[model samples]
Target chain A: MTAQPQIELTNIDKHYGSFHALRDINLTIENGQFVALVGPSGCGKSTLLRSLAGLESISGGTMKIAGDVMNGVPPRKRDVAMVFQSYALYPHMSVLDNLTYSLRLKRRPKSEAEAAANEVAATTGLQKLLRRLPRELSGGQRQRVAMGRAIIRHPKAFLFDEPLSNLDAALRVHMRKEIRALHDRLRATSVYVTHDQIEAMTMADHVVVMREGVIEQQGAPLELYDRPANMFVAGFIGSPAMNFVDGTVDGSGTGARLALPDEPSIQIGKRLEPGRKITVGLRPEFLQLASGDEAALHLSVTTVESTGSTTYISSLGEPEIVVVVNGRTDVAAGDKIGLAIAPENVHAFDPETGKAI
Target chain B: MNRVISSFRDGKGFDIALVGAALLFLGIFAGLPLVYNVVMSFQAVDMFSLGTFARPFVGFDNYIAVFSEPIFWPVMRNTVVFVVASIGGQFVIGFGLALFFTLKFPGSTYLRGLFLVSWVMPGLVVGAIWNWILAGDFGVLNFALTGLGIIEDNIFWRSDTAFSLWAVIIANIWLGTSFNMILLSVGLASIPRDLYEAAALDGANGWQRFWTITLPMMRATIGAVISLGLIFTLQQFDLFAAITSGGPANSSNVAQYWAWDFSFRQYDFAKGATISVLMIALVMVASVIYVRSTRHEVRG
Candidate 1:
């Protein structure tokens, strides 16, 4: 039989008075899996991570860690360490002491605790800074201390609550790779929470997207991007979010008619009831400029922005369509251009329910 | 002169004028009195020379007399006990209440505000209120003690020489606890909540969290509170005046109240000034600590 899941929650619920902070959250994390609970603010991603750490008590349902029911276990007893968004290093304690705090609490010998701290500090690249207090260190060093504190415990699972959100942009990218490398080296189960979809996509192996206290979807990072089960997940997963336009199935039953001026229609590549109203989603990167005979839609460019590596071109009228062209583009504003996309790249959702069709 | 006038028009003169006004006020009201008190402490002023500043330079004679008085050692001992016991009791009880209120129970804010009633009421009024509470036969304190079986009879808190100092200390603690609680609450609130969460996840129990997270993080605040508490407790004289009046042969006497008793009641202004000068030294140390801790807070 397969090993028991590292952490399991079934029908977990949380309520703050009348506000449902988390509802029907059922997640199972296996051993050594890095899971990310990602969403916009107020989406209960942090709440779910805190619940796993036992910082928040679930109002309903069972929680298990390593086959043991953790229904009422305190955070200390849960054997999970959390790195907070604020880093939360003990300001009065030196880096070594902060790393050794858990070991000391277990009444370990001073020599043993110091040895353990030294080893962890070496791994976290904090060897030279162990004697310094948190306030005496820079922000990135403090972040390393927070990570080292969690690492020393060799905890059953690691909980990271937006641990890199406080760092500068360059540092955030650097820490993202560093954390993933550290997780791989330790082979530890981790649940990270972040609002930045890019961080979640790059760092976590399994991404759980949430909205309004509900898990919208959870799958491998690419799976969520390739096939978001619904419109919210679709809109949330990609950068420069997916664009939607009102459409209806054309008379051919295999294409959708556009609502934009000039009535440009797209091939849906699947048969559907003719005249059925639907919403169509197109990703900006998938569209390309094409000749008139090969084009599915003709558009007037309203604005063109170049970020050196890629150029973004937007259409001029109702139902604005944007096209991202890799490298430089000769296209200018107010120019009429023909655009094309493969039928498989076009997505259709029911207008009423916003469900993938 | 033109430059000076231009500076005035540019508002620099107004800034200097404001600083000068504050300095002038302090020099006239606080600085001069302090210097005069120090000077009087070193002089041989008696009833005959009370109206003039040109008294004989006694060269520590007033300090010698004040220190060698029969009641001096007992009064000094009582002062130490009063300050220590009042601060200790206020700190422990106030810290407990502050922690309890941080639990954020419904109506906790209003209840904490209600505790400030004891602080806002004049200390004399508090002492008078405690006078009845500590009354020998009909006092509620006696009634509660007897009801709880901690004591079988009333102890005569105000008059009994054995418990008289303690009686005033109890009242003083009650008078000061709310201020301590308000300040400690602010300190507790300033500690980031995430630190506690981090400690908890690091496998620390609640007790460990208090020691490892709460206490260390509150170092500057605790320093500030205790120093302020020392200064305030030493300045406490109203409770003694209204309750014990340093009575029963000075059993409940302290430096501040006894200084007043010597100066105004017994007409020994030199001894009074000598005692106050000593208290000023103690308060100066406390002020140094307060300033340093606050500066550390800013740097942090």
Candidate 2:
């Protein structure tokens, strides 16, 4: 939250032969911000991260780091370090050597490199494992070694390309917490890329949602969740992905009504032109089972999944809703359920263009 | 049980028959000759005394005579020198060439094709070509050297004892380098690009990366190339036969050519088989020791 931008990308364009990999992009990140780039695979998120690290060359436009132009700079000269998705640790070198490789390349004294390596290894909780080679270490240990190498350089920024994609589910959750804590302790400017939206929501100071080489929306995590600019962002940001139902707007002057297919009509807070095609977006968490005598849309339950804390009910109806209910809901497969959603929780978009209305 | 028997009777026998045929072919063409050579090495026979089942029983006498000959020891020494020097020079030069080709350059593909000419030519043709170039009087090399004022007189390259060994060594080196270059080049290409990028960020420059990353990663390739090169170089005969014919006081005579001389030229088959058996034993021992020492370095 400062006036100075730590990293700035202006009108950056990248191409692979005739294929445009990254279109014109302009972004400015402030100092010590943890920014996450989230998108589906082949969406150029990793490519953008590599461009920032100077691991890849941009076909056009300017990339600046801390007020200095970084175009045409080799990665070693860019003063930016990257943690690859594969962790890319040198198999032949021990963890200690891997951490101190850069310092040794700078021709620092052996004692100094070893001391610095020990310090970083201790910080990463790898002090006792310094003598182990990459193949001998577990996946989590190898990932820590990769991070330790990046941290030992004390670079201007850190770039991570899907750093935890190879870990098991439990380890991924643990590493995600560790990364957030490390970022907090060091306050380092970092740009991380992943295809996992949950990671982006939990870890980023700001999340950038991208699709098909374009940014759909970029904002604080809750800001994006509450006010997505487009249907794509609304559907991509939430888990059980925001349920979308095709409908048509009906109603006159001051208020509007959504005429859902084979389901109950819904009232809207905003006015809309009657007979226009539209879609309604609702999050699974916002939809729940209605109590006795409550006005709701009746749906036939198709399946029910219960975790310890919450139960999810999938149903067949006009809008085909998914409902997240509180724990201990008496819902089962092949049962009829009443679904209720508030107006404030409903999002409407133009059905023709998928843009938020 | 009936169903299982029916299934087996339906088709599995054909595959077994095909495999049996392959093994039979290998046994006749490969195994039989090796067995015959082992048995022949123990027989005392000459080319002039060719009679069915009437050869004298030599036991270890042929092997003893092979060790007793003064010429045999010198030829063995020469063979060792030729194999070691040629294979070493080929590996170094070929590896350098492979590394050079890995770099981005203009017209590199075409240049690589041009460099493969020596490897593609048959061994006899290569020997003939080098023989014409290294001839004593009108060889292109001496003519070029004299014309350039590098030498006042034409050097009889293949006629002199000192120069003949070097002449054959140079030809063998040229012939062997291309194989090494192709194998090592394939190895270099197979390494992931991300490893190099990671190494670069870790501060490894060209030389450090080459030693720590490239050399260790290509250990299997290097071992295979070197062992095969040694085996091929030890059996070299065409260059020596075409250029020196193991002459000039027999200074450049190698074990393979000496075996041929004993079997064909001197008509002493028993000593020839003995030399062949000794060469095979030496190669097998060297290969086993090398593989054992380097096995730990290679990843599965």
Candidate 3:
């Protein structure tokens, strides 16, 4: 992030007649940065990406690319390449033709365009399928061709709109690395849009979590995982989700009393007003098997899923909590187990506002 | 009986039965007329011999007479012009309309549905309406043309030798434009919208996108439309029958009208069948191209 940023969006807003699609979006992407916009469906992430591409117009705001004001400019005038969710490979064109389409439109000589296409094909592993039509190629090959088509252009930015959502799990994992590797080799700025937080966590240098047309927070991947700004983000960023339980501050300011019968009250470092209510948040990965001489919550396990590499245990209680163990466990359904977590691993939130406090 | 019932429920037998029924229908309605026409072209027949199949075999005499007639080459030229002109006019205007309506303005689809009126109306009825529009002295077309200053006088669309053939061509184009527009619209709609978006992001402007994306994707549909247009134009007889009637010394007499004239007006059945058989050969070539183009569709 040296010098000036490559893309700058300021107070962007979009409306479809009476419906507001995007509300006051402000973001900045530095050159050579790979940013992922992660959110649930209908969260305006795709709309924001399309706005950057100029496929959609911003009703009110200033959009800048490489320090040039870009409002009212058509998509063609914007030097950006997008891999559509559908791949959108030209059905009537061979792979080489599809890759060299932009170059040809610029009236580049045949040899030059062919050399460019061939170079991209070599890296994308599309050399063998260069002469094939899109329909004749497999889904993964078409996906590569789509990537190749964008990569060959060397545009100011690369925008990917759920480019890998169509692949199976195994292929999806494989292509994820391929895309990240491609991004590293080519130091162009990229903006990726996806609903999968794991994809954002694994790939992006910076993750922007959006909800209802607003940016909830943006930071490095692990930063988002370790500390979420709000309760919605804490539940969204982690796999298997975080658990919540209601509790009241004990007479002692250092601990909170559980709403259950005959249990040890949870400990917190910060002191709160006695008898104040709070919502407790705990990540599944932080919970462990209870050890002797520690404050622990003993409960009956209702379900155990052993995936060989890790075991997932769900407790049976009024406020059900999940625990992820490192390896295979002997615990089965309806087994009594005690769960323990450190006070530092516990997160407290204002139950009324669902915000971290 | 059990095997028959089971086969009807789920087997190859049911498929064969459906195909057999279609073939039987085609054989009765289409095959019989084509065979009869071919046989009659080789036979010497009169009005009295029309009811019987025992006419004397003539062996190329009817074809020879048809070629040697003074009006034969003119009629052939007229047929070519009619087919070419009517199809060209219909296709260009229709494609323009199709693209225009694809913009999806308010009430556009309903307006397009209204344009289908020309396609659904009987061709003879269309010709009857065009007759009044093309009337010699006070026709609306001539009045509008003169008023626009494109023409200085009221040209006789149905009577004057120079304008009679064009009168039918104009009417025929109007009759066929809507069908072409509707079909081309479907072809335009079938293209995935994201292709254009991708092309736009690839640095292609509107015009370049049209040539690079829209036209190539519409190759199959355009081929089908043009071939179908040729067949429809060749089959166009009502406009000529209603408007010109090949009057003013065979000035507007195309092969189709001449074929009807030789058969019903002059009782020369052999020559009429000879002309129609030649038309069938042309339509067969068009049909082959239509089939090949559809089979080569590049689906996304």
Write one digit per residue (lDDT tens) for candidate 2, span A31-53.
Answer: 99999999899988888998887
Which stretch of 10 consecutive residues in model 3 chain A shows the poorest summed lDDT?
Answer: A290-299
- Model 3 misplacement above 4 A: A259-264, A316-318
Each model's DockQ score: 0.64, 0.42, 0.93
Best prediction by DockQ: 3
Tens digit per residue, CA lDDT, model 2, B1-300? 876666557877667777899999999996787776677789878655655546778799999999999887788788888998999889999999999998869998789778889888887888899988988898998999999999998888888887888889989999999888988898788777788888876667778878778998888778878888878898788888887888888889999999999988998888888888888888797687558645755331
What fraction of the true interface does each of the listed models get right, in terms of native contacts kept?
Answer: 0.76, 0.47, 0.94
Question: Which candidate number maximizes TM-score?
Answer: 3
DockQ score of the complex predicted as candidate 3: 0.93
Write the residue-wise lDDT of candidate 3 on A1-357 in tens digits.
568899999999999898888899999999999999999999999999999999999999999998899998999999999999999999999999999999999999999999999999999999989899999998899999999999999999999999999999999999999999999999889999999999999999999999999898899999988778888888899898988788887888778866654655878656888888888788999988875656367677888988889999997677888899998888889877777788888887788998887
For candidate 1, write residues A263-290 as lDDT tens digits. 8989987889999999999988888899
Q: Which residue pairs collide in model 2, if any?
A: none
Error of 1 at A176 (Å): 1.2
Instruction: Write down the worst ten-residue block by lDDT for model 1 chain A.
Output: A315-324
Steric clash count of candidate 2:
0
Candidate 3: the clashing residue pairs are none
TM-scores of all predicted structures: 0.97, 0.85, 0.98
